[model samples]
Every structure is written in C-alpha cells, then in structure tokens.
Target: MNSVRYTWPEGKKCAVVLSFDFDGITPYLWRSRHSQSKGISEKEQRRFGPRQGIYRILELLEKWEIKGSFYIPGVTAEEYPQAVEAIAKCGHEIGLHGYLHERVDELTRDKIEETLIKGKAAIEHIVGQRKMGYRSPSWEMTEDTFEVIKKYEVLYDSSLMGADHPYWINQMVELPVQWLLDDAIFYRYVGGGASVNPPANPATVIDTWKKEFEGIKKYGGLFMLTMHPWLSGRGSRILALESLISYLKMDSEIWWATAQEVAAYHQSLEVEGKNACLTEMIDR
Candidate 1:
C-alpha cells in the first residue's frame, strides 16, 4: 500500500476534506426501483436529511467556520432547492452526484452520459454555475462512467479508493475515499424488517475516526471523510463530528480544504512536474 505525499499549500502537514453526499431520499428511491411493495419507513427516514438534518449540519459547519464539499443528486437538488442553495450561499463546494442516484455500473454507457448531463444541468440551474468535481452515486463506477466523466471535463472524482492522497487517473484527479470514513456505514439504520444490525455508537465511531486521522496525518496523506446529511445529521452524531473537528483543529498544521481545492492543487503539482503515477489493472 503506497501513498503520495501531496504538497499541501501553506506548508500544511496533510489535507483534510469533509464531503457530504446530500442524497435526500434518492438512494431509497433508487433501491426501491424494482419493487412496488417498498415501505415508507426508510424513505421517510432519508427525507429527514434534506428537510431537517442538512440544516443542522450547516449550522454546525458555520459554527466551526469551516466549509465542506457537498455532492448532491439532481433529484435531491430539484426536490430540496432551499437546502442546495443554502450550501452554495454559505461558501461550500457543490459537486454532481447523479440524476436520480442511479448506479453507474448498472446503466448503459448512453444512460450514464445522459445522467451526467442532466445532473450537471440540474445543479447549474439551481446554483447558477457548474462545478468541477463529481462523486459517483453509491460510490460505484464503471469503465463507461470513467469515460463519461472524462468527456465532461470534470476536474476530479472522490468516488474511488485508489491512493491515500490525490492521484491522477489519466487526466482526472482522483481524490480517493474509503468506506471506513463514511457515516452511512456506521449510523444509517432503518427498521421495519429491513435492518441487519443496529447503528454503531457515535462515540465509538468518532474514536475510530480520530485514530485514522492521526495515522493519515502521520503519513502525510489525505483524510477525506464521506458522510450523509441524513445519516450524520442526527443530534448525537453531529456532536461526535464536532468533537472530531475540534480535536483536529487543535493541530493547526492540517490543511482543511474542499475537494475541488485539493484537486486543483494536485493539478498544479502536475504542472510543476509532480506527476501522480498512473494506476491500471493487470492480468493475474
């Protein structure tokens, strides 16, 4: 497992990017695409994210005086215009997620391209400008997905778990993410005979995050946290997140930045002859 030491701006030891996937209820809808007997329990729970959870998360970020990157689906943006607008107005990065939280691997190349165009249009219509970065819905991508993103000239992608720091996937910057740092893996639990287990305790989860952050900081890698507004918007989870934020802020050597900013810096590095090694699959 190799890592790239990104030359973070301002002589920081490492870069920290907090990204939120504002899916609203799109993930639920996408999951229920095949069944007509879907229950409302999970759908309503997910709706709480846009309707209430997002605002709480926004306020928390405002209190910390830190901006986060928000990747929103087109349907989520159309459904929750106010929520999406608030994020942009508060000086956060808004990136494309998908049209309806569609799984890229499950779609054809044409469908993937259509979704990218529609998703970009939806965000631009609401925010008055197109963004540079994109995160695939459900963190799933295919060969066609990569080609479509490259065709659109997206600056970077945060869906892949390739390197610990930013790297180049051909022309696009890859800000890798891991499931260990995502909130949904720990806190998204909906009942009604659907849940396999209960959600993890927030304190325990945050402790694990802190340990990972320390390790990443020691190794001088990127600590990119992927979270959901609906899942991490809960009161206790928010408190846990704030605790982590405060703890990280105690060390002023960390470079806190948006995903786009980090990607741009990596691009700058490439121009300065700091090219990231290309990754590819080889026959076993």
Candidate 2:
C-alpha cells in the first residue's frame, strides 16, 4: 500500500461524513404495529418516529452549518416532498432508503433491484434528481446487495454492514460501506437502556465517535455516521448530536459535506490521476 493519500476538498481538510437515514418521515407510515398489543403508545412511537427526527436533525444541521446525506424511503419522500424540498434547500444529499421500510435480508435479489430502481425513481421525482447512493432498511443487506449496487453504478453505499474503513465494492471503488452510528443501532442496542431514564453513557458514545473521527482524520478517511430520523430527533440524543458537532466545528480539519459531494470529490481525485489507488484502477 502507498504511504501517500488523496487530499480532501480544497477548503476541507479531513473527511467527516454524517449520513442520516430518515426512515419514517410520517406517523401513519411507521411500520410499528398500530395495535396496543405490545403496550406501546401510538403517540410515543409517532413522536419518536421519523418525521420528528428528521425535523430535529435539519434544525441541528442548520445550526451547526453542517451538511449530511439523508436516505429516504420512497413512500416517505412521496408523502413528504416538503421535507425533501427542505433537505434539498438545505443542501443535504438524498439517497434511496426503500419504498417501504422492508428489510433487504428477507427480500430476493430481484426484489432488491426492483425496489432500488423504483425507490430511486420515486425519490428522484420527489427530490428532482437521481441519487447516487443507496442504504438498506434496518441495516439488513444480503449478499446480493453489493452486486446490485454496483450494477446501478451507485456512487456509494453508506450501508452499516461494512468494515471500519471505506473501500470499493465490485469494479467501483467509490461506493464505500457505512457501518454504525448513534441513532440507529447504538442508542437502541449498544447500551443497557432497559428504560429511557438511564440510557447508555452519553460521553462514551460521543468518545467512540471522537475516536472514529480521529482515526478517519489520521488515516485520511472513513467517518460515516448512520443517524436515523426517528431516533436522534429528541431528548438526550439531540444533545449528543450537539456535542459531536460542537467538537468537530472547533477544528476545521474535516469536510462537513453531503454524501454526494464526498463521492464527487473522490471521483474527481480519481480522474485527476493524482492518487495511486485511482492510477491502479484500469477501469477508470
């Protein structure tokens, strides 16, 4: 491996990719059972659901002057074009999340491709452009997911089933996989949150990210945060978000950009023939 690394964007120094998975943008669309069988309140689920999360995230991004990638379900985008429009206006990248919040592990390869194409179309119609990125619902990616993503020539995959660092899948080195973040798997599973009163150590979670960001900055790569619209939208989680951004903003070493911008920057560098990784890529 070459000791040299690719330089980040002109004004940007390190790469800090904060990707949000805005899954349930509407209360009605939430797949959580409507029945009170489980003793979960509809209001509680909806309040902590996708729409609220997205709104909170948008405000936070605006406050921090940061940009991020938002993966939207097709139905979510169709139902909430205003939200989509706001994201576009705010200059955040929008990518495919799925038409329904169905997990990909249960779906066939054909179904996956169909969903990808259809969802991409619907999202494009709502957001007014074809998104180059794709993230699976529930972090449920199958073996065939990568093949289909490559087939679509997707610029990247911020999907959670990946290694610590970013790397190419198939013939393209662009669409690197994204693993985990605080919103989706962390607050829900990583901690002993038997009740909301005493959740995971917030500082530890923040430090985990701080360490991840430091490594990415040190090695010149990979700080993909998988924030969900529903989870990170409220309470202590939002404060955690604030802390993370405040820390990052203190040092302007990273490029706080949308996913598309990051992909485009890497693509441009690949075109420039300055990085050995690109030079060795014969397909380029």
Query: Evaluated with lDDT, which candidate comes out highest?
Result: 1
Evaluated against the true structure, the overall lDDT of model 1 is 0.87
**Candidate 2: where are CA atoms >4 Å away?**
1-6, 11-13, 25-47, 140-143, 150-153, 160-166, 174-180, 189-198, 277-284
Model 1, 142-236: lDDT tens digits are 88888999998887888988778887765678899999999888987888776788999999999999999989988788999999988999889
TM-score of 2: 0.78
Indicate the worst ten consecutive residues by lDDT in candidate 2: 189-198
**lDDT of candidates 1 onward, in order:** 0.87, 0.68
Clashes in predicted model 2? 2
Pairs of residues at least 3 apart in sequence or in different chains that clash in candidate 1? none
Candidate 2 lDDT, 169-239, residue by residue in tens: 45444434444354544665322243454445666778888887887677676577777666677677888
